[model samples]
Target: MGCSNNWCELYGSHTSLCGCFVAIVLHGNKYITNHKGQTKPTVLLDCLAQWGIEKIFCIIVDNATANTCALRKFQSSFSLLSNEAFVMDGEFMHIRCAAHITNLIVNDGLAEVDENVSTIRNAVGYVRSSTPRLRSFELWIDSGKLTRGNFPLDVKTRWNSTYLMLSKALEFRLAFDKMEAEDMLYNDYFMEFEGGAQDGGRGHDCYNPEESDGVE
Candidate 1:
């Protein structure tokens, strides 16, 4: 179970091949009014009833306070019914999402290098801002004797995208330096980021290959 922007997404997973392979299926989605613990359990129960699903081995949810409350309520309600509804009387019914846990840890570690990551993110955004700028950047890459590849922009919510963005950008580090030296637009592009209100007055230098090491 996961709620984002007042929408709750429920997924169902079952073990196949005698508990060897796990198959995940999307059960349903509902537009939630809020993230209240009470609301979530009720919504899940309603979905289960609609699906005619009575027995569930476990429920995996992200680490959230509301999920804790929802699990407690769900378990209590299930306990009222027959014990066959759970594999072990709901002893191991609540499972925390491992991917979410890892994402949380990675995001925490990346916080220390947030500014450095932001610089590269903004640099990529600059080049991708328009077709003309992209052409100029490609020219720089060609002149610098660097192989050109698609520069993937990172999605802030996913740390893996940031890693890809930085790794790919490193290939064209020399090209960025070349742009800073030769392209006036490229040089001025970063000036707006320096001491800007949006960035909380954190001054940024023009993207430098040397600074890429900080993020690495």
Candidate 2:
């Protein structure tokens, strides 16, 4: 009843601070296959039946079309089981995940500044690629009296990681500029990007330490 892909379902309880109900435990966590909308309701239904739960207040999910489909299927199937399966006739049962929505918003905004982010990502990658290069970068940081911190490489899919990498990289911008001038490897490293640093080459702005700093 499962496929190659792994899917997880989590259920938690929330109560008001003044409520006497305490020690709420998670009752739903299941491994399934193909978590698309069509398959999601079936699995979730099975879980509800197993746990003997008949009423649902809400189902929080990301803004994926599959989730929307899943919710529709769940509502219809659950209603067949019991007329009172959902609070308020399931009108407010589908709650879009706020964190996921914020992530989407941030990623959309980041798309407008892809080049600048890429430039900084590449610079951070270059510096942290090797121990010698990192030591040289540290030397530059020390010379410039900048705070030394761990360089973070960002995952393209995660905006929070990108934000952290950019924030940390900003602390050593002068060191990056110094490395661009004093370090031959750093200079040549950028030179290899999308042809040399000539007119219309990607290396033109990507090679500059201040390129990512322009992002606001």
Candidate 3:
């Protein structure tokens, strides 16, 4: 852990315990492959020694198994102290950093309609299947009878951003419905869900601009 004149900090990087695949590199981040049972702490120890770090103050970890495994390995092997927040130390121990805890919560628990969600997601993929369809969607939007909501494509966007998908596709109800009538998803479950979703009588930010999105 490192320390500022007025504060102390600890730091370590951890990824998803579920292993969905990600490679993030912060200024001091070192890549490590972690698995269950054996060999990781030794490898991590070697890496730290190579980097000339003798002590770790905290290990920032999240829902991924590999990350959880790695953090435990580090804690057992070394004599580092435990703290839940960031500390300016050589290596600190902190589990479930703010962003990661939120991710874990979302991944583990969120009330949503799954089937309708998939229908909306696949629509974009379906559109990409044919350039003509894509072009038609574009044209539909240009005709002023449709509005496009944000379609987030980030990794975290997969399951968590269904609302965004609904808002986007649902906004252009006429265009989407017209397209639906002529194609594969004519009787889509999402169409029904969209039609009966939260009433828009009053302003609500369930789907809104400039709000922090949720993902698990």
Kindly list the per-residue Cα lDDT of model 3 for residues 1-216, writing each as its tens digit.
111111223345522111121332212444434345344455555555664555555444445666667656666665443343223542435454556566556644443533334444556554555556566666656544222333332233333464455565555556665665665543342344455573222111132334324321
Q: Rank the models by lDDT, top first.
A: 2, 1, 3
Candidate 2 vs candidate 3, lDDT winner: 2
Task: Work out the TM-score per prediction.
Answer: 0.72, 0.74, 0.54
> How big is the positional error of residue 55 in model 2, measured in Å on the Cα after superposition?
0.4
- In every candidate, how many clashes are there? 0, 0, 30
lDDT of 1 by residue, 1-216 (tens): 233312223345432100101112223454345667777667666656665666666677777787889779977886666667776666777877777788788889888877877877888887877777887888877644222247788888788887788877776778777877888876666666455534421113434556556456
Off by over 4 Å in 2: 1-29, 143-149, 194-216
Off by over 4 Å in 3: 1-34, 37-39, 80-92, 108-111, 143-164, 182-216
Clashing residue pairs in candidate 1 (N, C-alpha, C atoms within 3 angstroms):
none
- Give the lDDT of residue 213 in candidate 3: 45
Q: Residue 171, candidate 3: how far off, in angstroms?
A: 3.7
**Candidate 1 vs 2: which has more lDDT:** 2
CA lDDT of every candidate = 0.64, 0.65, 0.45
Output the TM-score of candidate 3: 0.54
